[model samples]
Target: MGADRVGGVRRPVRAVAYAASGVLLLAGCASMPDSGDLRDVESTPRQDSQLRVFAMPPREDAPPAEIVQGFLEALTSDDPQYATARQYLTGTASGHWRPEQSTTVLAGGPDIQVDRTTGHDSGDDYAFTLTGTKVARVDAQQSYTPMVGGYSQPVHLTRDKKSGQWRIDVLPQGVVMGQSDFQRNYTSVNKYYFASDTWANSVTSATAVADPVFVRRRVDAMTQVVRSLLSGPTRWLESAVSSSFPAGTALRRGVASLAPDDQNRLTVPLNGKASGVGREKCREMATQLLFTLQNLTPTVDTVTLQRTDGGTLCSLKEDQTETVATRGSVKQPDYLYFVDDKRRLVRIADGGTAAVAEPVPGALGEGVQKLSAAAVSWDEHTAAGVGYDGKSLFVGSLVAGGALDAPVLVSQGKAEGDRLTAPSWDARGDLWVADRDPARPRLVLLEQGEGEPLDVRVPGLKGRVDAVRVAADGVRIALVVKAENGSKSLLIGRIERDEKAGDRPVVSVLELRSAAPELEDVTAMSWAGDSRLVVAGREEGGVQTMRYVQVDGSTPEGPPPAALTGVQSIAATEDEQLPLVAYSSEDGIVQLPSGAQWQKVTKDGLAPVYPG
Candidate 1:
């Protein structure tokens, strides 16, 4: 026999022996004594990585406050089905309550106080108020949105007429827990969907956009991700991206468990809605599954789709996925481009050992037209540069004899600092730039980097646009906006295009949300991965630092990159394996390679950037 402590109670582990077989079976068991002096057991906190927590059921004749506390603690336990949590509710409430409806994350533990206004001191009825500061919310769709303000919900308990016991009769629809517990239980995962506007002759050529959502980390994560993918893109991205799965598609009835086989092959069983699709469409569906699962479970290298009748609809291998849909802006960049001391656009191959910088092949590189900043297209065949005056924008080819086109776009701001910002290119080959003219601030987009620039309507903009960077998928864009108080912040917005408007579609940026709400000043930022960005900013009354923030406004798990001083601009690629490039007033152009310290690339270079 051995003893172990759980929930601050000592329980014995016994070995039972079968006389006939002469075999010993070790088992750990714990039970509450039916008739004993009751004592409170402190709920174990999930602060340690290796600790497993087991929840206790409702005690006999527990007080209303104790009952509420027990239920709340049980909500944070690792129980897969939350069976122990349901034990604290009444029979009717247990049947009607839906814990999976949603989750409310508070800044800390909720405060439980008896509601005096109810005045139900009759011993048969009681009411309590659960209050806390709102932090965030995870909806049924697994979407996590950061929120602010107060949270006050009422919980009612009634005495059982026969059992003479107290049970919760009225409560909120979903569970509520502290922010620490929420972080411990849930994780973010990206679901892949093809860009609706990028459909070409070859399905593999379409671009894949990442829609991030949160799910329970220890629960049926694989199944949850698959269901989320089948449900289609979230509401914010529905207009911009398309899923290969057909409408009303779902998992086959009675199929609950999903896992990969020994050979790293995942077989997904779908309903009849997917049975009618042809081989090409089915392969596209499989491609989405392959990429979506690979993010969560890297071991899954192949995906095979099955119809309702258990017949194979289609199968796609990992190597074939790229042909179906390209991951966001993952093409390797040939050179790191920046502006040099002479105002000419120059490049260094892979931040080379010799640190030699050479001028690019274009009019802007010839030093005839000095440039303040520049952006290279993903294909590396074209480049856009903002003039030294910050009022004119020029586009030229990378070919040796390529000529510089006249200023395609110009700003009217009186001051140079208020004029056009450096341009950015999307994977679709379109160019985006923000005109910071205070009198006429607007976002401009060019179709294939030419023709008349379209004014992108931003419905809820409350500040002046200072800088802009568009993600490769073309469905999202990042901006640095200056407020009236002379502070700058980072924001992420969704790009929606109305193709039915006319020959040229109407473009709009919707739902601009803070990407770095904690930072009071955001100097520079760039896309570092599918849903992550490397941000350079500082909090109020704090020193400058660089960190990674998700589009949903949540910080990543690991520690931020090593601090860099005076980062005027920064650059990163969707491929995280590549080194990070940045321009600092203190150190000039520097690159941080994997497992190494920052090394100077050139003292004359500025505005370092990789291809979008």
Candidate 2:
């Protein structure tokens, strides 16, 4: 789901010229270099072929069971049109089999057992049953759904009269791949969709949102990605989001000859149904194609839409557009702020080296001397911090004449390690905090004005809530909880505001889901983009790693970024360009700009932060 369906906050878009109307995306982790050195280092061959092709065909003299096993293994290959996998089927059966209908992802290699009936003839002697645990299912429409249960696929084989070779004659459509094979062959990609523009013709105000879908890297990826985008959002998001393509919209030539021109401009010809759409609508459709194809081919800088007759529909330059309505539109601030060795608030320009990160001209920046952990508000006007001793929480203005006001909240820890977490502010101006008090653990929310802080009830949390960050949408909250074994877990919970009682604002958590259950320890997390989070956690070995996870509890495929030892805290924003900033005890402040490699920004910095 995109930002539009997040928290029920209707994120509208604004359509402008090509340059300002585009959406920004950080380079994806799925696509690795096509070729690399293999002599001195271990490496897996990159899968870049147009189809899944296999090296061997069905053995001509093999038994029915052997042929069945060969066909199953071939399904996992990059065989063109699955021609090799089809070799185990009769010519007629091969033509009728539809591998694109659906996919069944299993937990492990299938357990296949041969079965032969008593009265079966020579050709009728081939029958088998496959058993395994179903991990997930990708329906014919390409919507993925996680599931858990027993799966059984029955296969029947018959002798081909012409070749006298054993071949499958009865089976279901689509294919099945084991967990290990699936991980190596398939990669996830996000398709872009736009929210309905409330002011389309006059001044467009709807933004594009990314809907992630999986595709085989060695298969027809470009065509599949485009077709999925045109088909619209998945079942879960359709109610909350809208698409720009008109009803009955489709490709003109259907992914064939869909190539970029000499200037690297992608020419997409649609059917006659799209010819009647308005100019603005055509531009919106073009934006969708540009973002969807970005991962496939970065050389495409513009998209030209055409009709079947080759008449031009609309064209959009890549640089002239921006995805203004989604969370990606929250551009990075002029500088990242952090506390220096002197315990004072300081700032640095985005790319580093513009100037030393000097203290700002405000109370917290110039006046305050002692600080431990802190966070800045979205507008950069206010700052919240924990006292040097970690017992008190204070809030003050970051403006020129602001003052370091008295502590607004405090906690009495039973031990030196039980302290309050860095306070985080949401878009609605509400501050959230969690006190790791063994005796009285609580998660509280503070409204701007002079009202008593309200405690949020989380039903299923096992231990103390260590950290709480409210999403920009104000409808979801991420919590880092410390379990009884001292390990930490990262969880995402839905924030439900009770409106029936009119006395005061009441918020509670209903459906809490484990966002990164595989990680052993979760240290920190921040909203990287709409519906996506960047988390700092450690696997079983206890080595720190960073990963990107969806709020829906699904993790993308890829190894974690390079290790950063002693990361005390990490910060990220909805802006995709800001990068992942962390405060390391060994190196002070370090930033992973592309989420792949880390670089030092400053040695004197302590708690680095970007506006939430």
Candidate 3:
């Protein structure tokens, strides 16, 4: 045997002090026991505290090329009305330039090339070609749309002998900003939209979807958000959502100016066209404006809509228009459930009514052993769980002794490492799961537990499926797929049901598209509204973070409502007002109400979930 493996023991020596003899002695002993790495502490990460504001670019005489570069850089600054940046433009062009028409966000600084073919003399003109990667587009209404392509901005400059300065004579209608400045100077905002089915009688019951757009944080954000709302949803979500603004509807003037009245209510002056809308429609329009503006500021308690011709259309108080749809379902769930440290399914009522998450009454609630992941049904009458062993899946009622006689579904994993992800319930009462077995990665659907499990084939998918969440409409599915590159991504696919496969409709993935190309590793996700999803993922080489993203792969501009550190799982109801719940290793179960910080709801919780 080798000396290390034999009976011989290694030792470390230490120095010892002998006060009696006034001398130091060396001592030898066995090696000290090895200690493990230190455990990490739990706390919210420090937020960015540095103040950020836009500054005006310096006004100085310079060459035509230099002036063009300076003017381009100035457009990124937060100068009020872009006054300083306009200095590089001729007097006529400066007044005509409309930066609000569009904002082109580029991936990097523009590569500019000035053609000096013409002699540099007074009244001589030079053309500059600017090229860059366009990442996003902010339209006149301030709606943000992600685009992937190259863009060229050509501008003409003229030399002014009087000032010995080069000024821009002709240019594009909008401005361009580098990615860094675009993120800090602009913010994502949500404009309220109602379901397309909304009618006079269904207005009270209709749900609202939040159409996210990017707007200048320091500019008139409230006005921009409202104007975008009036313009309707983005093209990606136009098919799924609608605006109450009637056809050919427009502000009384070009853009309405909003001011607060003595009662602290916003008075909006629209053009005569607004008066053409009926009283009920006008009230609904005001409600939409109220909801959109409230997210920016709370000073305005009501909104008064009037025509530029001095005629009042309608006025609505914020509190009086509470029935408007913006988030989740009409009736919010009362409690959110999750598995505790003991692997017992428990629930915490809203408002902290329940000090502890008592075991749910049903068999899976308290009696089920070694439960790994669980999801509550839409009706809240049943739940589906994955066994801790990662093989068996159980579905049962929420009442006492309501579990099925045996596990309804069983997955085959080559090793203990293979596991089944959490189950998600769709509005049609279907339970969806992905068996993450390397040998057989597939999506399985259980139709309300009334029939056998069906394997849904995702045609053209080259990676293994991790998790899936079906939308309320039952036609779309949000999937987290592990790519061949060893990273996970979020993809949205249409669920096509073919009637040719016997009595039950056969489901298959079709027209699959990336939902969040920005996220490199998608760990968890949930549907937040009609056309958006709250995703938990990490950027390339970045820590995991949560944010709202459109189904079409566009990120919203607003920060995540809460900080999620070491969060294992998260869940939220369809209703926007319902508190968001998550399970963190350090904080246990945490809940966050609208506009509130995360609050610990319980200790030692995991896989928090809400009713479908």
By lDDT, the best candidate is 1
Candidate 3 lDDT tens digits, 1-612: 110111122222222333245454432321111221111111112122132233234245555555665566567554658887787789999889998889887786565654444444445676766677888778876666667899876778887778766689889889886676577567776677765544432535455555667777756667766667767777655665567677655566665455577887887777555667888788778877877787667687899887778778888997767655434444467678888888878887873336777788788777446787888887788888888877888887889866555777877886654668888886557889888888887898888854688999798897988887876655568888888897988888866666578898788877577888788998778887656788888987887788888765666545775768886677865667777777777888788888888988887878888876
Taken over the whole model, the C-alpha lDDT of each candidate is: 0.82, 0.68, 0.70
Rate residue 597 of model 1 by lDDT.
86
By summed lDDT, the worst window of 10 consecutive residues in model 1 runs over 1-10
For all predicted structures, in order, the TM-scores are 0.91, 0.72, 0.70
Using TM-score, give the best candidate's number: 1
Ranked candidates (TM-score, high to low): 1, 2, 3
TM-score attained by model 2: 0.72
Stretches > 4 Å off in candidate 1: 1-51, 200-204, 351-354
Ordered list by lDDT, greatest first: 1, 3, 2
| Model 1 lDDT tens row, 51-148 | 34456778778666666666777787667778988987899999999988899988886666666777567888777777788888888887777788
Give the winner by lDDT: 2 or 3: 3
The better candidate by TM-score, 2 or 3, is: 2
lDDT of residue 340 for candidate 1: 95
**What's the true lDDT of residue 117 in model 1?**
73
- Window of ten residues with lowest summed lDDT in model 2: 1-10
